[model samples]
Target: MEFKGKLSLWQRIVRAFESFDSWTAFSLNESGRRFGAAYARYAEAMDLFQVRGAKRVGVEILGEGLTLGVGGLLVMLALALPAFREVGGDDWLKKQDLAVTFLDRYGNEVGRRGIRHDDSVSLDEFPDHFLKAVLATEDRRFYEHFGIDVIGTMRAIAVNARASGVVQGGSSLTQQLAKNLFLSNERSLERKIKEAFLALWLEFHLTKSQILKLYLDRAYMGGGSFGAQAAAEFYFGKSIKDVSLSEAAMLAGLFKAPTKYAPHNNLPAARARAADVLSNMVDAGFLTEGQVYAARRNPATPVDRKRETSPDFYLDWAFNELKHLSDDGKLGGDRVLTVRTALDVSIQKQAETAVESMLRQYGDSYDAKQAATVVMDPDGGVRAMVGGRDYGASQFNRATDALRQPGSSFKPFVYTTALLTGKFKPTTIVTDAPLCIGDWCPNNYGRSYSGSMPLATALAKSINTIPVRLSIAIGDGNPKIGRARIIDICRLMGLTTPLVDTVSLPIGAAEVTVLDMTASYAVFANGGKKADPFAAVEVRNSRGDVIYRRDRDLPAPKQIINANVIADMNGMLVKVVEEGTGKKAAIPGVRVAGKTGTTNAYRDAWFVGFTGNLVAGVWFGNDDYQSTNKMTGGSLPAMTWHEMMAPAHQSVELKPIPGVPTTPGGKDAVASASGPKGFEVAASPQRPAVLNPRALDAIGGIDSMMKSIVTRRGPSAFLEPAAETNLFGAARSVGGRMALQ
Candidate 1:
């Protein structure tokens, strides 16, 4: 205006441009030259039109000013033609990207990432006043504008020119919707033109309400929240309908800069910004001064909710599964997937808490720096998993990724393999004496020996020598039983890790993951059915259509082992908890059957077990393979297992271990040796050939002890009378100087 008042019209334009910095002055001059050229072309076209009209009328018809005005209209129409072509395409009207949400087993939302659409609400669901507040804060003339606001654009340009940087955006709500939906956020002349064109397209195609809805649904709120309803829920912990005027103003203020004005991060700054929005609302006539004052008095503060545990481990596993199930195992861009997972969030939290607590409690004393736990159902649904003490500190999923040796936890499979061959029963006496197979010599912990004991007793105590001797006997050039037989059993039980056929294989030298181990234990829990542990149960799209759903009724689980073998395995494992190494893991009212494991030099301690309904596996050790301070499987690992499983079974029904005898104390009693419900163990026709004289002598002592115990107990509940081996010897005394393994 100053330049216009001081000089002639032409001189005023030139002087005003000359006063600008180089870039602004150059842009203004270039625009003027283009405008002049267009005007010249339009002038020529108008003159031709006038000549034709005058030729018809025999006189000049139209005035020069009117003709020039009509010619300018034609030039403007030509400039707008390209934008029409660009926005007329079908792709321009597609929906914005929807985020993925993860729900727990009971259909409660546990996590959300990507652009989650599960909680998106329609515009009709929001209060009218909230919508009014949004429009007032963002665009007061939204209903009257075509698409681009010329006055707003000019004001923004002037402000930016003065600042020498971008300080404001001239986008209306619809224009912002266009940019968010179809364009990248890049500052360039071409992109700006496209944004303007798309905004016009949106206004032409959608109603004002539709454009506002799109904007509200796609806007980013802080703390991984997107959309209006999610933002409200994230900040206020309530539905959009329940948001007060002040809360609505606060949410509206976040549109300008979510993190900058995020009340969760800086309350004072957010309140100040909200005050600006409230003032805007008052000025826009959407709110009265009194209303604005009332709103300003009660500002909404961001909710102080922090996630209990990082669900990254579970989500990462689910995402991999989702990708594998998608076309060609690839996830395309901007997908909206709802995964219904088998995770029990409560149990997961408990597991995480237990791991951290255990580490804190015993880490210094035991030199144990890392631990992992996995909980699963008998039907193969994973309930809870703690991959590490802190997922934020380390994202590596030790439960699913680390393949440490399971040690004695692997003994169950070895015992199951022996039992499945019909040659061994839980009570079948096995020698616990020290034995050397060629160059390999195995020793029990503390070099202890129970002389000769029942197969169940040796397993209960985790006597290392007996399992090795049994593996050697089963695999000793026998056509029926190979050294690798336990490997096949492990695979059937869901252990995917490879195993070696060494003599020590039965003592759990094979490396395996916690998930596989837990699933393997579930086989016994499910009564011999093979459990295929899974995470995702169903997946849905943005429109509430299920893209994938697991078929729960897949042909009955493959029967790997007989029900009798499972029963016998259950009985023996129960005894382990009752009277052996796993006694620390016993839940007083509920029956549990499991095994304890300790690796060489106490590098790894594992406790894997199962209740009637749930199976759990726990591991304790240093990540770098350093030995713990003599922490056996019965110590921290068992304690952590108890801590996790006790809470998990609180609401579960009390059930006895199938085929086991409950104690006179009730549901926890040892099984009758005759077995549950007249269950009979068939005697083997051919007995194992005792190759070593020491083994033969050891077996004779075991037979005599079994005979003595059976006599005293009037049919021992666990041990059965064994068909005596050929070699015989006097029975050794019961107690030994060394401690039991």
Candidate 2:
């Protein structure tokens, strides 16, 4: 076993060193060193042995030399075959169509974004000190090397051997560029060989300027800037021609670690790296000592606040829309698919501007915090989305991904559920006092409530106990009835996360995402239909063939609530803006209706409302979930909603939620801009009658009758009948009998 191990090791070394036929390979072999002249003479002697071994091949003295050479060459070729095949894509690489989104200047969706990516330009246009800095530091011999530098390779090999590590980096800029653009991130002998072959080929086939241009175009700069031009814009908020040397150096130094040295991240680390680049420039003669000193002393100016991006929100909505199209479920496929999203530059600009204003005003205490916004055409087309303050800072996508307490905004769902299913209505009355499920107690934002307010009044004021009491009064005994009890309602509205059904869930406990809640509101906005909110309207391939069209009928908005109840709910929501907590969301001319939610921890604030034409949701919170600035939904989010919605309603009139029309895009679409001029509610076609509020409340906040049927806490686990009876028995015993009795 020991001898076999040694033999295997010797075989590997022999194959490695004797493989290539070049003198470079022969010089590396130890045994071949001793055989120098004899090895050459052995070739001549092979002719005499060849005749004797003609009948049957014989192992002659000369054959030994040829055998060794041939066997090693074959081994090397075997190892190199796969690498030599291609670096990145040969025929296969051409198949992939990258997923890139293009937005208008105001960051609104102009149309479908991204393609095969076939663009390159000149070196001078690719400004910023970084490229020059990279050229200086990485390869001074780049201009001189004819692709594969024999001397550089030799030096690298010597250093590698001495260091007992892969320390040598002799590949010229051409080689490195080839590896990056064409090769995988692999370090192997085979990779090195391929790099050499490709580099030489590139040198012969492409000009030096072409090579540099390609390198600059393909370079990855941090902060989502893909190329040098992009890097310059990201760092300086200006064109490449406008970048200074220090700024250029900062970007150039990022070739090592884009995220770590990104100007927005660690200014100190970025500066130190820039100094290193300046030093390298001095050594490379790109700059003199005086220039270097000047650059070092001059600090890079602050990169201007970039026009904000909304990749997270757009991607989220795209993914949401993708589910309808992707039967198999994957994106960024090889197909040249085009997605037509319903993003309006006008509304998106308003949403972002509002979010930015809030962040600028209140972000000091909410440092590193983020906010998200979503606006939908009552039909569920997501016209605008601002996921966070900075999409590049972190791609966590709080708008769509985050699941935080909806504060009081979730009350409408529970209230709406009661209105639609059986016996619940806005006119129902319930006390806003201490409420409990087993040992758990829930409270309002101020721990105060009106004694016996009507349901509409409670919701408008965002009083906590009304929704809880209403949820129990109607949904009691049926798990499907309570808001906290049923997550499928949330699911029906496009909510993907689990709604934790805790005791306080009636008051927006546990957590739900802004999207999930906003989508729920869409049901109310569109006359009780729950159209799945979507960013992509229609998707076409590069050839303009429709590949994926949003199925307006499939994930169709089922009648989740009654039209009359919806009308009543909207009437109350309007009061929320007109006379309640959402005052800041009130638009001057636009008749807006919505709800406000502020979590117990004050960690999240939300305002969701709708005009005649649109329904928008805005949320404000620290990305880390820490609370400061003491912001409430009524403050920042409502104000943002007001700011955005006010302008969005310009040139358009605010009408009631349009009724479902027969066609997808028809008069109903236009009708959304204004109310029916002369339509009489009594004469117009309408749905089921709202439940008698007095009769439903005969049970008094369904606390006892149905406590067992619904999920006990948040929106998760189901409650047993036995548990419900126990809970019900206590609440019923208050007056010597259950409230229902």
Candidate 3:
């Protein structure tokens, strides 16, 4: 205006661009200034205005500035046309809603949750007041103008030019709407050009009524809700058409700062904005004079509300499964998916609470910030799974992941193989003396030897020597009973990790995952049938059609071992509970059978077991994979297993180990044996095979005492009647130690 006071058209045009966001504004103004200065010099040289005076020269410069400014703007508009906003399509006009995911919460833990659609209101159902309030509060001249407001732009330019030599926006409703719907709200000439072009395109493509409708329906009201109908219900719990005057005005007030003025976030701000919009509605002739007075006196009300919760952890886990199930969670080429899982809310909650409590109890000692627990039925249907202590803290699922060595837990596989082959009985004696294989010389827990011990006793105590000897006995010529047996057993259990093919496997030298370990125990509980452990039960498509279903035929669980052999193995494992290392795992009333495993240096402590109905595995370890604070399999892991299984067994109808003597005629059927005493006798090879000769010719002090007890007590006193192997039958009362593998 100052330049226009005396300047010509070109000078005023130059001044017009004094306030702009882009470098183009500055560059254009500088060029105009230079041109003006050069023009003044040329004018002085020619004496074009013969009556040259200060006022005349100044007026001439102003005119020249305005002319150049107008022409320059037109040229820039043409050149920067491509950067202008393009009109959005009909579909885009419908509106886009912010996405929210739901989750399955069990106890204090969370599981997989899915997304659901709740947007019920559509475009045509909107009311007239919605448009009136929106226009008054958002774009006051929504129906009367093009996309860009030239006056608003000039006012904003004038204000900005006075401060810090910068220009800010004075965008009208149409221009602001255009920026939201199509162009980005960036302070650049490109963005401004786009906003202007799209504003014009929208004006031509959509009618005044249609534009107003979209602006009302698509405009952000507050919170995460999009569109007016959504905003109406989101703010006042009512439809747009049914909204009261105060409610409508309050909804409109959300335009300035939807979140800040949201009745839910700030009722005072919302009421102030509501009053302002009501006054604007009156000025626009849309509201009555009486309504304005009423609205001013009676403030608009905001609603009590809460944010929709997000299924952060559960959704993340579900997505991972979805990725593996369908093609990256899509079905039939559409990015929609549904999964049916066996996660009963009650059971899931119980499992999660139990697991979390265990973590809290041992959090300091275990130094374990992360843990995973899986509970499954005898048939392998996953009942519950707590993926971590806090899925929000870390997304890595240790339940399905974290494959660690089972240590002595892997011994059962070896013993089971030995039983399956019928080559080594529980009563068969193996050397418990010093053993060193290759560079590894494995020793018992205390480096003490039983000299010679039976298979049942070795397994009962979880002795390291018996597994090596048994593996040699079973997998030797067949190569399928020992080290190979471990690998084969893992393969049979559907494990993907390779196992140690050496003799060390029996003492748990192989790496196995907890899921596989639980499933392997499930096989024993389910009558030696290996069932698949799976979390997903079924999946559906968007059309409510079942795309895939789990085969519940149970497949008869592929008999992995003879029934009697399983029974015998079960019988021996029972002893593990009766007097061996697994006694701490005993559950009341319900018969439980399982193994205890502590790795070398006690780095990983594990207690995994199964009841007649459910199988659960609990592992306590540090993430750095370091030794724990004096933790062992018999400590926290066992306690966790008991804690984990107590609720699962409450209503479960329990069963016994398939081949064990839970009833008569079981394969493990045998005349009970007496406690071990002095039946084992050592004899010199040079002596006769007869008992008296071997017993009389005593080999040593311990041997002579064993011979006297066997001779005095009789063979039945120290012998297990069920033990079929009597390789030393001829020399029962021996003086020297018995020679056995």
Candidate 3 segments whose C-alpha is farther than 4 A from its true place: 1-112, 118-121, 126-324, 328-340, 359-370, 418-422, 469-485, 497-506, 509-512, 538-548, 551-557, 560-565, 662-741
Lowest lDDT 10-mer window, candidate 2? Answer: 679-688
Candidates 1 and 2, the one with greater lDDT: 1
Best by lDDT: 1
Candidate 2's clash total is 16
Per-residue lDDT tens digits of candidate 1, residues 143-191?
A: 8889888888888899999999988778878777777777676877766
Model 3: per-residue Cα lDDT over 1-741, one tens digit each: 343346789876777666444678779999999999999999898786564568878888999999999999998788546644254346556434223222221112232233222334554555566567777666665555676667767877888988856645476766667776776546797777676667776787777766665666556666656667767776777777788777778888776667788888888888887888888898888888796676678776656675443333334545555555554433344333456554444445555665676677666766655556677777786666666776657776666677777788778888877777767788888778776665766788878888777888888888887777666677574434456655776678556676757656678767777777887887777877877776455555556565655664225567876777777777777777667876666655556677888887777777777766678777777666777776767666666666556554443334566655443333233212121122111211121122221232333334445566568665664565532133244344442443311
Error of 1 at 181 (Å): 7.7
Task: Say which prediction, candidate 1 or candidate 3, comes out ahead on TM-score.
Answer: 1
lDDT of each: 0.76, 0.67, 0.64
Residue pairs that clash (backbone atoms under 3 angstroms), model 1:
98-115, 99-115, 99-116, 661-669, 661-671, 662-669, 663-669, 673-717
lDDT score of residue 35 within candidate 1: 100
Reference-based lDDT, residue 388, model 3 = 70
Q: Write the per-residue lDDT of candidate 2 for residues 1-741, one digit (tens) a residue.
A: 445434578788878776655667657685577778787889889867555444445546567879899998997677656655664445522332244444332233543332223333457665545566888866777778797767777888899999999765777878877776667668787687778777876787789988887766565666655667767765777666677888778877877678798778788998998888899898887778887777789968656544444445576557545554554643334344556566676567667776777678656755426788888888787778888886667667777778888888888777766676657567777688887667766677777756887778888888876766766765565433564444555666666777766666667775777776777788778887866776765565556555554663245557866678778778778889878998877655456789998886688889988865788888888767887567788877887776676666554434655432222332222222221223111121111222222323334345434544454453222355655566556555544432110
